[model samples]
Target: MKGFIIYFLLSSITGNPLMAFLGVIIIYSLIDRFYLGFLPDFTRIFRRNRQMKNSLKELQVNPQNASATFSIGILYFEKKKYEEALKYLEHPKLKDNETANFYYYMGMTLMKLKRSDEGKDYIMKALEVNPRIGYGLPYIALIDHEMEKYAPDRHIINDLEEKIEKFANTENLYKLGRLYKKLGNKEKAKNLFSKAMVEYSYCPKGIRRIHRKWAILSRVYKIV
Candidate 1:
């Protein structure tokens, strides 16, 4: 997927159809061999970790680029390297809205690692720096959702639904559908899920997952 995204980006910049096609084939082959064949999930995670390590090395050589530092931090967080993410993201020299996003993701990583107090501090700092950062709200909602012990809240779910609707991306739509289902709004869930199915059908896994979800909803709600 990453290779395909990179290829597509290059193709967009260079206007080369053959290169884009080659990129698709390369990504497909890699996905088939690794994800569909025999590579363990941990192996994929390790590869990503190594990639982040290399990126961090590059960032160290050019510490003035905030984008590189933030990207490296994001990659670290994605690999669950919370301490490393914090080390880079908490650099006092880094100060900007992008750095605020780093703090938000760091807080989310710490929260996932079960350090709520430290996580809250970082999240508060994120909001202090950029109150309108979209990512921070979702993290807060997640924390609230977790603390509520999985008991669904219509109000919170509704707010998320509104945000997802306003944003209207494939991921946000899928999440909105799930949240609506959790909140017992089956009709709304089905509609959002159908929209997501249409929007994300290019990706096989996403299509399959959405179809399975719709099948279950169909049984439960008689949704056509």
Candidate 2:
């Protein structure tokens, strides 16, 4: 009702209903982009670009700045520039970092580079550092699939199942279920799909934002 009232007032002021509707849409999109986080954040990309530029400047002054190098690598990784990401992520200064996230991103970038074996190794290191890392299991499963291995790491799969049960991570369940399907385990896949649906149904409102995309995808999975 409030939206309609605003639309009506805007239409009266503009003397054109179509223009008013477009204006309302623009305002709503801005609100979602800034406050609701439902829209893509263009500002974040710009901010990252600015940070990357600053990191480059920092590197010119002190080539031994590991943090700046890692930051640049992360920025490039987010931009999907895997080769550039590797250059900094593999720097000697970072050899002893032992950060789980560092290894995880290195593994993911290597996987993108089609170096599945190296990717798998780094992913394993990440799991050793933090078994419960979000998305770690899924990437392991993905690498297993890429290598044409029927047996995904059972430890990772088991951990993901535990996470789903404890945290109601519908996304992980859905993805793991897809992995099972790809591995030709129809029965396990179907069971996980069912659980994913049920879990999404019972997902709490507070965490719905995290699960909503997977929940919607699971609905489509149910039909197919």
Candidate 2 weakest lDDT stretch, 10 residues: 138-147
The Cα local distance difference test for each model comes to 0.63, 0.76
lDDT of 1 by residue, 1-224 (tens): 77667777879976997878787776766775544443335667788778777777877797776767777777877767888877777776566544567667877767767777777677767767876556324544453444445465667555644544554545555565666577677887778767765655555673454334433443344253
Residue 78 of model 2 has an lDDT of 92
Residue-wise lDDT of candidate 2 within 77-160, one digit each (tens)?
999999999999999988988888898888878887888878878877887898665554535345354436565466765654
Alpha carbon deviation, residue 54, candidate 2 (Å): 2.5
After superposing candidate 1 on the true structure, give the runs of residues whose Cα lies further than 4 Å from its correct spot. Answer: 1-55, 58-69, 91-99, 114-153, 178-191, 198-224
Question: How big is the positional error of residue 89 in model 1, measured in Å on the Cα after superposition?
Answer: 2.9
Separate clash counts for every candidate: 0, 0
- Residue 101 accuracy (lDDT) in model 2: 85
Which candidate has the highest TM-score of all? 2
> What TM-score, computed on C-alpha atoms, does each candidate reach?
0.46, 0.72
